[model samples]
Target: MKIKRRAMLESTGLNMTPMIDVVFQLIVFLMLATDFTNTEIERVYLPKADAAQADDHPDKTRLMANIIHRISTESDCPQLKYKNGVLLQPCQIENHWKIVVRGEEIKTQERLEELLTIEGNLDREVPGNPKTPSNKPVMIRADGSAPFHLITRVLEAAGKALVWKLEIGAEKPPE
Candidate 1:
């Protein structure tokens, strides 16, 4: 007796569920990762420089210190009222100036120094070594109209924290 053999062909399709899930996960991860840089940065008019270098590559562990200059809304100056159909300049008090770090406003220099010290100590030459200098980099982003004294104070704080690596934010002049 002879047995007959038959060939069976079935169509197979690729399951796209895993691929879609992976794509969604990657999108979420990128959104969360990029948010850190955006939140730390503040809206400040940077000084224009002829020799400003573009930051093609940025450090991930760099700390950002933003100095914002704010004009006082409640000023005692009578010039705030329109005179001769022209509005005068509002009072820009030094007390209105504030330093922001990591989306938190730093009211006092001592607190700012303490924050910087803690961040600096996160990455030291010797692990958990307080005596060694910090390997962390810091960037100062100050408004063009901001007072120089404020920048000086930030410098002092950074120096005290032993964070030697520093970068000043500047914008290139429009051609």
Candidate 2:
């Protein structure tokens, strides 16, 4: 008698449930890991420029200054001053628009004239072509809370100092 044999079939279906779950988990993880925060100055409104470019190159040898306007503890009026990166006591707070360089506080007309003369003398000492401007530019990282008047004053001072360029904005780290 002939023996009857049966053909065996194999299952070819693949389960995608685990893979889909993992992909969703990865998406959620990435979305939660990224954070966007702005470090704008407090209480001061910054003027917005519609035509401003997002990616501008920062000057390499730039001089930085911070302008702070606060109410004086002794007086009720607002006071302006130039502070270094850190708010140290050496800061000059007498006038909001004046800045000191090389141990001299430049504020009045006479002082400014003296300052310019001193700067000219120093520039003469450097061994280089007098016609060429300084390689270093002036970078003004004024607080958004700072007044426009103060910022303009800083720009004017930098110009008088023969700074190659003037840049004003908040500080950002390089990518």
Candidate 3:
């Protein structure tokens, strides 16, 4: 008895329709997820330094303050944006700097202090007493062109808020 083999194994091609649909779905999901997180953060051109290091608390709940210089925008510099509930529209002004936190611009140091204080107190069970020694960590991502006074103001506000665990975000200089 002669046994006949199946012809060409009936070449079954991969079903790409499901894969393409899954890929499109993933892209849509990522776009929405990234937009939510990024909208809260202002784009900052962090100062570069030799001592710049990687963040130790990558996943910690830390408040951020974005400081950018307000002047003419060059190829190297970016335009000043107003964080009015949403970081929208370019703003016109003379030589000055602006600070943004949680998509809201900190118009005054008092407001900065107030905002930080409120955020810092959120984790505390008691109004003034913190269960932990340190409140939430605060990071200041100041632009390279931003004035030193702006940075000082941010630091002062952080101090007023009693944020001891603070960090200045910087980029590593090119080797």
Candidate 2 lDDT, 151-170, residue by residue in tens: 66665655565554555554
* Model 3 misplaced stretches (Cα beyond 4 Å): 1-35, 56-60, 70-95, 123-127, 130-133
Error of 2 at 159 (Å): 1.5
Clashing pairs in 3: none
lDDT by residue (tens digit), candidate 1, 1-175: 6554442344367889999999999999988877554678898877777797897777876789998754457645442233443334532566767788988888888998998899899988887986688889899998776678888988999899888888889888779
- After superposing candidate 2, which stretches have Cα over 4 Å from the reference? 1-62, 74-131, 171-175
Give the TM-score ranking, best first. 1, 3, 2
Local lDDT at 8 for model 1 = 33
Assess each prediction's global lDDT (C-alpha) against the native.
Answer: 0.78, 0.47, 0.69
Ranked candidates (lDDT, high to low) = 1, 3, 2
Q: Report the number of the highest-lDDT candidate.
A: 1
Q: Can you give the TM-score per candidate against the true fold?
A: 0.67, 0.38, 0.61
